[model samples]
Target: MDYQIARHNMVENQVRANKVTDPLVIAAMEEVPRELFLPESKKGVAYVDEDISIGNGRYAIEPMVIARMMQIAEIETTDVALVIGAGFGYSSALLSRVAETVVAIESDATMVEKAEKILQDNNYDNVIVVEGDVVAGYPKQSPYNVIMFDGAVAEVPEAILAQLAEGGRLLAVVREAHKVGVARLYEREHGVIGHRDLFDANVPYLPGFEPVESFVF
Candidate 1:
């Protein structure tokens, strides 16, 4: 398969055509070999304009959705980023291009191992894939300039928000069961965190982020 051509077409046809205007995000998407991040069986469909399951209920979300989220976050070249639910570390790879340093958290041991190998092999030196609970957020390196959830979640925990540096931004697709998801951005300023909806998305939810069930009496 001609991956370079397919990548170009993906950027022009799916991402750029969908209002993802940030040049940095566009360039990262164009440069990163997204196919390398997918299972071999799924690589042929890597550039399709839809989420590709990566097992354990996670996904490498649609390119346009991630691009729009990055654009909305306004990532800076010197910023430190934390990617929750790193999966195959694709999002972290994209971020490594634009951010100074990236810490990606994944709960699955096998995934962490594979993601680390792929990032290291590809020379994405700025990214560090760590195995840990995704919901906990990596507080050891708190006050991150940007925090991105790699998949949809039912809610954003305050603990995660607390890790945001003043003036930092966190982006996630917030979706409740049987409800539509909205891409939301949370920003911290003057010690206050405020969030606003960016766009609607129906991406899959990351494990351990599902809403707790309530039982009717």
Candidate 2:
């Protein structure tokens, strides 16, 4: 499959056609070899308009969703980023192109190892893959300029929000009742975090980010 051509079409059709106007994002999507991040069995469908599952409860979060998230974050060249659930490191590779440094956190040790190796083999020097609890947010690298959750979550942990630097931003798809979800962009300004819903999205939930069970008597 002419992967380059497929990448181009994904950017032009799925991303740009959906209103993602960031040139850098368009370029990153066009440049990144998304097939490399998927298992051999899934590579053929890398550029398709659906989320590709890489097993173990993780999905690559469709290309357009990623493009829109990056567009909303407004990543700057000087920014430091944290990617939660960095499955296969595809998103981290993209962020490495836009941010000064990227810390990608994964709870699964095997995924951490695999993603780190792939990103390094591909020359994503600015990204650091770490093994950690997804909800914990790597505090050692706290105060990130941008933070992104690769999949949907029921709520953004307060600790993770605290890790955002002043004027920093974060993005995620908040899954609500009846399986509905809203993509939201959150910004920290003067120590307060404010968010605005951007669009509708539906993706696999990041493991351990499920909503707390309510008591029903």
Which candidate has the highest TM-score of all? Answer: 1
Q: Rate the local accuracy (lDDT) of all candidates.
A: 0.94, 0.92
lDDT of 2 by residue, 1-217 (tens): 9999989898888999999999888889988999999999998899999888999988998989999999989999999999999889999999889999999999999999999899989899999999999899999988899999999999999999999999999999999645688899999998899999999999878988877777779
Cα error, candidate 2, residue 114 (Å): 0.6
- Per-prediction TM-score to the true structure, in the order listed: 0.98, 0.97
Error of 1 at 28 (Å): 0.4
lDDT string, candidate 1, 1-217, tens digits: 9999999999999888989888899999999999999999999999999999988777999988999999989999999999999999999999999999999999999999989999999999999898998899999998899999999999999899999999999999999877999999999999999999988999989898887878879
Clashing pairs in 1: none
Query: Evaluated with lDDT, which candidate comes out highest?
Result: 1
* C-alpha-based local distance difference test score of model 1: 0.94
